[model samples]
Target: MPLRGILDRWNNQSLARQFLIAGGLVSLAAMMLVGAYVTTLIEAAVTRNSAASTALYVDSIIAPLLPDMKTSQRLDDVTTRALDETFGQGALGGKVVSFRLWRKDGTVLYATPDKSMVGKRLDPGEDLLTAFSGQMVAQFGSAEPRDASERSRDDPLLEIYNPILQPWSGEVVAVSEFYEVADEFQQSLHQAQLRSWLAVFGVTLAFFLLLSAIVFRGSRIIDHQQQALTQRVTELSELLSQNKALHARAQRASLRATALNESYLRRLGADLHDGPAQLVAYAALRVDSQLLTDPRTPHQAREKEVSTIKARLDEAMDEIRSICSGLVLPQIETAELPDVLKRAVDAHRQRTGLKVALSMTNGSKSLPPSAKICIYRFVQEALNNGFRHGGGVDQSVRQTFDNGNVVIEVADRGPGFDPASVGPDGLGLAGLRERIESLGGTFNIFTSKSGTTVRMSLNVQEMEQA
Candidate 1:
């Protein structure tokens, strides 16, 4: 298949499976490249540094021996002693040296690994006789010997050959040799490669783990959203079914109920304005007249009566207002849901002297009166629940709007109750849920150790019909 087709197929798979495959491939490739690069660079640097350091060490050893060799007439003993001292058993403990001293006649005077090689004609290939003509030669490779059996079993070697120059004329006198075991340098390079692999392995493991976690979390969120959408669709289907059955009954009952509700609200409003308010005004006049005329009645008692009358009047006014608001509207109209929510929150805060925060986003637009009413009632019920159960008096309420949905969340630092433990008898939230779902919306109530949150989303199109 083409790469694009393969990717499309992979994309259709579960997020976790796709992530594991893609992450493993990418991580493995990157690790391999990094490992190769790091191992090569480190090995090269180590080889170069080791070679330079060894060369310097050899020069230091050979430099001091040059003067001693030029001054001595008895070259054999002087050369032997100098060789023994320079390549002392301890000095060549971790190194290999094959030194051969020669006279101007191209004959060997001393060769280490054996005293027998002395007095032998220098083999041009096996012995570096060209260095005797006042030249320094250094090569990193295996050594050759005249006797095959005397050759090194270890493969590669780093050898440095320097000529012994006469101080006066700078003429070549004798030669010095130094060779290093390559196994140590090779082992260092192998260790560097191992470290590179280990580092790459560690980073790859962490990368795969992080990728897996992201995939798992994203998959779970997708599943949750899908489930929520499915539930919402199911609810809407059921609501439509119920609406079909109730349409005839609603036509018969809704008009009468709405008329009666409006009439009751207007009567209640008039009763409050005409009854308790007027009664309170008359009682205040009585108290004022008593305070001015009656010296028999104590001032404190008169003042107590006046305060009691005022408290009763306030309670009566509140009762009347509550009764009137509980009545449903007679006619519906398109209203912006956020504006209704803001008014509800504002009214609650004003009555309780609590702080409220309202945030609206997107362009303010109109919604169906039913959705506005449902959302307004949801906020009202939530605030009531907060006051009754959440100890939300003098607390803060926050409402947020996004897209075409409004989220009214009232939180209090007061003692919270577990939503899971709420019984069937708790009709407040049940009724709120019914109202919200009646308009093809979703309702979610979340309560935790910190506080409680009630979230509901209304479909903008459906809400416009309401």
Candidate 2:
């Protein structure tokens, strides 16, 4: 039952409660076991000493006097005297002796402090039966019932019992007992148990307090790290939002540039078709008519003049054709940049009678009409420059598409010119560069001892949807 209760308490308690309860229980059990062991040891030691002292008193005085005695009463008197001398006065509650004399037939012959117990039949079931059998008995403290007078007192009594022997025959004759109280010892043990319980409780509380402090510190560090992580996430979110806005703005700018280029090319095509082409046609007609009918005295000078006029007219036709070709713009959503580049190369070749090679890498994909027209004009300008200033008449123009970019390059095996010497005002290459860059594209020119190459990259996807 006690074990079951301890198990229940252990299971029901919280961690701290369990610790405290277990500590207290262990301290209590250990103290109680120690106290019980100490009491038993003291009792054993006291019993052994008392038995030895009683035997010595009996052997030296009572046992020697029994040889001279003639009757049981006389032997009783000698045993009483011996007990009084050994235990001293008032030691056995003013009795001076404590002894019970019995015969071999289990009859009581004498008892100290009273004569009424003499000649009494000894009931083996009554007090001192084991003593009559010649065995020693020992007890500590008093067991008497207290009356009102004795109940108010603080002191208690102690007791001891031993068997007496006969002289010469060495037979047991009577029993003897003594007692003394020990109230102070019980009080001291109770105080020590209380002190032990208090020390256990104090130590348990201190240990719990230390553990709580450590847990609090660790929790604080975790909270700080979580807070820092949250702040960093907030900062990154804001940065991403700003970056998206910048990208949107850049896309809008590219669309605007594309629109402007397309409009410019459309207007340029209109001007050339309506004005320069008509004028060039009229001049050709006049030259043909004059060559057929007009006659002069030399005819040689007239023929030369007519020939010069015809040549000028043809040059004007070529210029107007070149201008119109440069103005060729396709639909932004439908035209492929490579196809547009091919058309521009063909137009320039037809107009100038110059051998031009076109090569396309990757596949053709649609781009904004403005982007196509810009590339067309750039090629026109490059071809024109090569025709007028480049030493080589034949040139290779290569176009490449990769990922989402379209690269258009025009190179000639010409006497390469120094880009630094040709300032912005000297060659229209600077204007071409400006036009390409305005559309969110790049323009680059490389001139070496062998040749000159102009390259530009247009974002095909951006241009097609602009």
Candidate 3:
């Protein structure tokens, strides 16, 4: 299989199985190391203890019989005979497979059952050196040893190095090395090693089972939680689908209503311009014609009255035309967001004849036609309020896209009005807020003694979704 396929298969396995496989391999390696170390120590201890017992027995029998070598280098006939009697047919007969007594000068003083090998100048091995230094060394010649110096020999024997000290001065005068038939010792050593390995295996099994039980319990808990989380996620997905549908419906309704409201405003503006504004203009023209085209000479006070009436009619006509212009909006539905905002600022500048700072940065995102209309109306109302109340001082219009949301701000550095006094219904602010919120956007106004700011933030992503 490919590497990715293997990884996927491994990942698909249950958590418990994965841990069991991994932890079992680790445990097996640990058991092998611990068991080997512990059994090796057991075999060494048994070999030493058995060798010490045999060495102690041999030392007891022979050390008393041997002549003190502090005075004589060679053993006499009687002393040599006593040593022969002990190893040949006495207490150590069959158990002693081979025995040798060495002098400090490396000459064999005695050999078991055969005295011809006596007086042979054999060099001392490392074991003999240790015995000469007043220490006993022991080894099992048929078993694998933990240390190299305690290495096994060919025959099945327990090798012993017994140091013989002089009775009076406690000085080691001679060393005795013996090899005993180790059938019984080997049996005991093998039994001990087996028992030790069984104990290690038992401990390893108990530890592995205990850890596996704990992990299995934890894995079950995690699996249960995963199932519950999956179910909760499914429920949330359904609810989100329903919310999206409701939001789309609300967006459609808001669009339709806004279109109808704009249509009504346009008809109202056209009516005032054609009916009330035209009639007012005609009345002003008739009064001016009457004042100038009259044949009769008029009195001074009456002439002034006719001229004043015509001037008032002209003023009324101008005010009517202004109201009509305010009601009808420009054709901004097809324009982009930046162009729409520019048109609003330009119109405000021309009407008020005041400087309005307009700032645009990153207004390149595509917006819905309804959103563009909403933004235009928002800027229009906020600027008009700022001008009427703030004396049009230091007016600034800023537009930007902030984290996928379009933020437009209109602010003025003038004496601000108290928001609480205006309430929610005053200055058409309530209508503007309704209009913005209906399209899933936000409107906020901040007013203080230093200045006033009207900010509108719209989420372009949500608008696009709608």
**RMSDs, each prediction?**
22.8, 16.6, 17.5
For candidate 1, lDDT tens digit of each residue in 1-466? 6999987998798877777887889888998898888887876667657766775666566566544555543345664677677666546645754666655556766667666777777555434666776656655444454334447455566566667677678887776555667777777767877988898889888988987898899989998999999999999999999888668555544554555456556766687777766767766676567664687879788777778767767876776666566555423355465567667787677766767556555565666667767767777778878877877744444555666565656556556777778764345776676566656678887776677777887767556655
Clashes of 3: 0
Which of 2 and 3 is the better model by TM-score? 3
> How big is the positional error of residue 84 in model 2, measured in Å on the Cα after superposition?
17
Candidate 1 wrong stretches, greater than 4 Å: 1-9, 67-81, 84-90, 97-152, 155-178, 182-189, 237-466
Candidate 2 per-residue lDDT over residues 103-128, each given as its tens digit? 55556554544455666775553336
- The predicted structure with the larger lDDT, 1 or 3, is 3
TM-score for each predicted model, relative to the true structure:
0.37, 0.39, 0.51
Clashing residue pairs in candidate 1 (N, C-alpha, C atoms within 3 angstroms)? 368-463, 368-464, 368-466, 369-466, 370-466
- Judged by TM-score relative to the true structure, which candidate is superior, 1 or 2? 2
Compare candidates 1 and 3 on TM-score and give the better one: 3
Query: Against the true structure, candidate 2 has what lDDT?
Result: 0.63
lDDT of 3 by residue, 15-105 (tens): 9999899889998999899989998898789988888888888888887777768877788899888877777789898788678888988
